[model samples]
Target: MNSPVALFQELVQAGPPADAAVHFDTACVLGGSIAGLLAARVLSDRARRVVIIEPDDLPVDPGPRTGVPQDRQVHTLLPAGHQWLERWVPGITKDAQDRGASLVGPDQALTAVNGVPLAADGEDHHLLAIGRPLLETLIRQHITSIPNVSVLKARASGLQYRDDEVSAVRYVTTTRADGDEQVLQADFVVDAMGRSSRLSHWLGDAGYDVPRLERLEAPINYASARFDRPETTAELKISGVLELFTPDYPSHGVSVAAANAIEGQQWLVMLMGYGDNRPGRTMEEFRSACAQLPEIFAEVTAGAVRGGVVTYHQAESRRRHFSGLSRFPARLVSMGDAVASFNPVYGQGMSSAALHASCLAAYLGSDADLDQAAHAFFDLQQVVVDAAWAISAGGDTARLDAESGAQVPEDIRQQRWAMNQITAATVLDADIARAFNYVTFMLRHPATLADPDLLARAVTVNEAARVTR
Candidate 1:
């Protein structure tokens, strides 16, 4: 087995494998989510036929769809996520731009601490803030265009096994009122139903040991509202802005807020708060919160509010330890939020899903045993899950009260202090900023921050910054 860092590097560096190796005769994906769509794209490369089981009546033109209440919230494509998107769906960024999404380069992106923007390092990394609706629509279009992939408007009910191997899937169509379920024969099956996935229950009901679930209580509430962007945005040299308040000085009880120049010539600004600091849903409350944030938030929210404030809440971050389980069936795997769902404030959902697709591609393209459980794929996926989980949950754990019944290890507490130092030093040093950005963008693992030289520099820079202050 390769080291986690080595595997991560391989996942990001490799593109879709050659289509010469066909692995499965028929594969069924449970949901038509971005994760599922991407998985279908990968399966189309290896499977002769791929069928997506989705319950929603998704429109040809993707405005807002049912079952996705969070579509109205602002979503981000980290630079690493953008790389995977381009690797999977070639020219997708350009397609989004043609359709009105903003393509923000490192120079055009802004990250501020306590209202002070970090200095630009002029790196080659770039990101797309296309918002969830447009991004999903474009990916869905590309996935549907593949000749071997088809989508079935149905809800997955259960699985059928033949001699302990997944042979088919059971689902009920959306138009059916008789409550009749149909079986679709699948040589392979993927569960991408997201956080609400019932794969565990299904497996337990069938006498299979289910993966143990782990959760961290993170009562996060955030609200987003769209507004008309200023025509002079280009002149301002900022296409994306993330204004963050450290724990020491949260602005008006708001921990973080962001403004992204999304498609439709508008800015999607979001305000987030933990536990008791819920953002208001009314327009008046939204504007009040923005006014208390940085100047950019005020300037962007100054425009006429285009829609009502959209709010979303997540009580905890969860992960299912599938690799730890030994009694799993062959020809079956789960990805995306089905395996692990993290805090959305970190913007890792889509990108992590894309990487999970990369893991699927790697597994299918490899010479692994097809008659056994997908432990190899799970190993590769664990690296990605651990990386994302650490970034999102690690921070949330620190913010919660000590009486919340959560225990923090001494080593983890020490590491968090070091990370805080490095983050604070980003505003003062460019080299450190680049390295920090690489980790935050999901381009590099969090372990890189622990390098002795980097930590020494961060300490030095932070001490000097304190003196200046």
Candidate 2:
């Protein structure tokens, strides 16, 4: 060991060696969204410099941005994501909540599934809901606190590599000082570029067989509009919602009272559908979707000032088999939408991405084994994501919709039994609801429902109901 001054001398004389070797001292993270930011934070801690390349000039305040379409829609940080935020960057939630973000206490935002009411003490958990822009802006504020981090207004073009090692992150930027082409040379580069990422193509061109992406696209349409908060205790709607998404009715919708959720004030409304039954972005079409609902949702929405409907259309859940890649570079990784993007109807993106961040931290913390770490990280991700897909998609397959082609005989039987069990259980059992919370919050897997006590009760309920009806 040497003193700080002597260490510098020894390092220079001995070619700057360390107890542990370093691949690169800097990383260029592509994309500046939630996942991109999370990946950048991790890279910042390990590298000497971190640059976040975001094509869209993001908002400096708590408002909508042109880049992220879903910003205006309802978004909430799941408890799992919240936990990671507390760990990765303290006071993030506190700072946002201090503004106008409303906190939905553990059990206050009650849910009724398949007609069963869930009861809870609401003691140990809480999920704070804030507008997407506010949440990201608050986080971006935290990012500025880190000296090594800087955001570049640029559009990433491609990746350049030398012998499988990424050399520079190629990009085109007009907003920087003189508006010229630029290259961010670094030891590592991360693709947090989200759903429209071109990372795979860039990697393919470098002679690496990119991951085989698994896509289960079924067209889904969403229309969302923001309204001023309602102003009346009598007119106020406190809880969120859940609806039909089965073979008989292949889609469901939800409405949330988001930031500035005060009595007699404005709130945001989002109406969505699966397959060909998707919702429309037009104010007229949006009203029609709401009218289809029983009451309150559309009625209240109709009376409020409506922001023009915004639409998001995508029909598949895609996951790249990156861990299965035979050849990959060290210090290179993909997280969030770059790796996989789930059907947002499930609201698992942020939570699952947080789980993925822990994977990133864990991978970096352990001994240097990039490939092993990648495989292990994604393997864990597969469990969480696949479980959610099964619950959401399997439920979709049960709906009797025009576009949801008939299921195979075996699949039919399985869907029937599974749907009956889950729907009935969710509506009736608090424990089942808790199990669902576990899955939703990323604290446990869906198979956690297989617990003896919970599963036995569910089976008993299923069998007794079958006998009675």
Candidate 1 lDDT over 1-469, as tens digits, reads: 7778788878877688765598889999999988899899989988999999999988877677775767888899998889998987998999999988988887678888898877676588888988888899899999999999999999999999877789999999989999799999999999999999999999999888899899998888989999988687546678888888976775877888988888878889999988888776788898988887777777888777787898899899999988867888899999999999888889898889988998999998888898888888998899999999988888787767343757778887788789888888888888888888888888888888888798889899989878888
TM-score of 2: 0.83
Q: Show the lowest summed lDDT stretch of 10 residues, model 1.
A: 398-407
How far residue 12's Cα lies from its native spot in candidate 2, in Å, is 42
Best by lDDT: 1
lDDT for model 2, please: 0.64
Query: Model 2, range 222-263, lDDT digits (tens) per residue?
Result: 666766654453244453433433333322342211122411
